[model samples]
Target: MEHPHPMKDFLVRAADLPWVPQGSSNVWFKPLRISPATGSWVNLLKVAKSGVVNRHRHLAEVEGWVVQGHWHYLEHDWQAEPGAYVYEPPGDVHTLVADVDDPDHPMLTLFSIHGPIEYMDETGEVAYVETAETKLRRYHDYCREQGIAPHEIVF
Candidate 1:
């Protein structure tokens, strides 16, 4: 079967994109790709300190690859280090924290998310939610603030 739209090939250099803060001083993200149709996206998550990034549950499956340094989930004992590929099943809840033994270098991971993430409080109560639209808005806002043309990073 043939596809309706031509496949698009794009490139995003981490060094070329601006790092947007992700609700914390130590945690940041660089959006790589966003799909409005399916609410899917890819991003680079960076953490500069050994601290909790968030407590969240995914509505869809999530996949990630550790690019540099390491991180672990509070609910799990296994650590995701450089070159490690991690997977999160739908509806699984966990708190992401950086394993920053050396502050000089931060942890970097590439994540492919399929759905919205429901951010939760320490008591397991819903705090806020992050969706594909919200992420796209953030990316646009960051690019505008930095005087970076949206086309330069977003496709």
Candidate 2:
């Protein structure tokens, strides 16, 4: 049996992707898909022990699945460990923290974001914004700086 449009399906080895720093020494991301049409993106976020992903609000829906280690939001009491799933509705603000005991294994989560994220300052002001396009540009910029050929992740 032959299936049509097989090329439309993407198979990626996540391990083969380079980790791009997220303006932090211990936080990085590996983008899997960047969809400009829907203003969405999917990526794996890695945070080392004691790393904080900062306080941010999602302008749209977002979902994540913990793939490695453990993490939790400072605003919430529950912790997310391996195999745990998380969902964030629009306008939900929270600060992500990774305080795992293991120093060698960082926390990794695969996230599917449907819109932009507003990084907030201490006074609740929007300090910066991150979107699918910005993430794509960041990946490319990191690749160029490291002398690595950028992969085509745009959809």
Candidate 3:
């Protein structure tokens, strides 16, 4: 099926999007902020590498689909596999967790969230320390180690 929107090229390479899960097990997330003009807000994320997307809330009603791999949230651990979909209402606490023994093997995820979702910093801080930049660095190193020409970290 062809997606109607004019597909915007991914300027950032996968190697540049380092996946990381903060101590919450195997949970690595590469967030792609979508254009609002697209009518529905969305973002592509890579999960299932020993990571945990701690419980969080959103202001707008949200929905999601699992392109691949699996995740568990709330008291229920639902696997939105390659062809599954999940609709999470606004303000619902979503505790997402993904893990893979081999860092070389990671689960792929495509999530389209309507409205806006914000991370409820349990640490009481403004932002999480290990973030986009940190992951980028890790991805760069991973690419270099794997003999893939490293992609310039473009912002």
Error of 1 at 55 (Å): 0.7
Q: Which scores higher on lDDT, 1 or 2?
A: 2
Number of backbone-clashing residue pairs for each candidate, in the order shown:
0, 0, 8
lDDT of 3 by residue, 27-132 (tens): 5455444343433433456654666775566555666666666666655755655667777776676667664455665666666555545565676333433333
Q: How good is model 2 by TM-score?
A: 0.93
Q: Please give the CA lDDT of all the candidate structures.
A: 0.88, 0.90, 0.55
Report the backbone clash tally of model 2.
Answer: 0
Over 1-155, each residue of candidate 2 has an lDDT whose tens digit, in order, gives 77773447677778778999998988999999998778999999988768788799999999999999988899998999999999999999999989767768889899999999999998999999999889998999999999998877887
How many clashes (backbone atoms < 3 Å, residues ≥3 apart in a chain or on different chains) does model 3 have?
A: 8
Off by over 4 Å in 3: 1-33, 36-40, 123-155
TM-score: which candidate is best?
Answer: 2
lDDT score at residue 148, model 3, on the 0-100 scale: 71
* Per-residue lDDT over 1-155 for candidate 1, one digit per residue giving the tens place of the 0 to 100 score: 88898667887777777889889899899888888777988999989988997789999999999999988999998999999999999999999989887878899999999999999987989899888889999889877888887644344
Off by over 4 Å in 1: 152-155
Candidate whose lDDT is highest: 2
Predictions ranked by lDDT, top down? 2, 1, 3
In terms of lDDT, model 3 sits at 0.55
